[model samples]
Target: MRLSELSRRSGVATATVKFYLREGLLPPGRRITATQAEYDERHLRRLRLVRALIQVGGVSVASAREVLAALDDDSLDQNERLGTAVCALPHGKPADADDPAMETARRRAEQLLELLDWGYDPATGATIPAYGMLVTAIAALERLGYPCTVADLEPYARTLGRLAVNDLDLVERYGGTADEQVEAAVALTVLYEPVLLALRRLAEAEESRRRFGRK
Candidate 1:
């Protein structure tokens, strides 16, 4: 199809499509003539991924480019590709080493992973955004006098591990091709986050009512 067809099919404007092409978020189509190019299904899939990254995921163009590059990198295996793509998009706040709880929380995070036997690359430990985020969260909880030790977090880690597997199962069940799978992963992860949180809150409310009914 031509650019107009791609734009119409994708529900994105021609100007936005051209902008993505220029920004390299979406790959260029095959040049049929000096001025015209023909796009295919791959382009449509890519446009969907690009739109999800920017509009839904709320990532900047540069970050979206990084995510797209990571997703399209042929050298990486499927797991690595997904991890790289996920990490490429922005996440986590910067660490503050000066905080008293930071070091303790960091140590607890590391120890908790070890206790759970969750394998992770120590080389990438410092670079993984989740590490810093976990540390920050634990540290904040510590200052607030909340229980955030390894024992306190172990059940969450276990449940979330199962949740991650379920997420992958859903992705494979619904998504067809590799590109489509990546698109599904991004879409589901971002869009379903609030659903998960709301479910958790509702569950807690139900449990609280069972334990402490105020009739």
Candidate 2:
């Protein structure tokens, strides 16, 4: 496909595709002439992934480049690649390590993982940011006088763990190449996170209406 066809098929502008090609987010097409290049299905797939990362996932160009690098590296196993992608994402502000509330929350996070028998290591680059976010949220709640105990969080954790299992099962069953699988995992998370949050809000509203309807 020519640049125009590639742009039309991928729903990305030609200029934007050229930008991606220059940025190394999308690989260059085969050189057919001094001024003409031929793209293929791989280019289309990569272009779509780049667009999703920037436009939908809210990832910066540098971060997206890093993610693409991780995805393309054949040496990294699935877990490492996924970790690299997750770590490349933006995260909440890091709480002060010395803050007493943050300390408490960190301990609680550890306890919760242990109680659930989850194998995540907070020391890992990938898991640390998420664990840090969890601690920050817990600390914030405690400071606001709504502290959640381990017991209170257990049910939510269990439910999410089950959902995660199902999520991974579906990903495995989708049956793509290693790179494609990684792309699918990242795309699914980026695209569906907002949808899941919206649905949860709707569910909360319905439950609230059920419990506290006006007379």
**Clash count for each candidate, listed in order shown:** 0, 0
Q: Please state the error at residue 208 of candidate 1 in Å.
A: 5.1
lDDT of 2 by residue, 1-215 (tens): 99999999998888998999999999989999999999998898888888888898889999899888888888899988987787777665777566778888888988999888888665762256777788888898887889899999999999988877877777788887877778778777677778789999999999999999785
- For model 1, the stretches where C-alpha displacement exceeds 4 angstroms are 202-214
The deviation in Å at residue 77 for candidate 1 is 1.4
What is residue 151's positional error in candidate 1, in angstroms? 1.7
Model 1 C-alpha lDDT per residue in residues 151-172, reported as the tens digit of each score: 8999999999999899989999
Clashing pairs in model 1? none
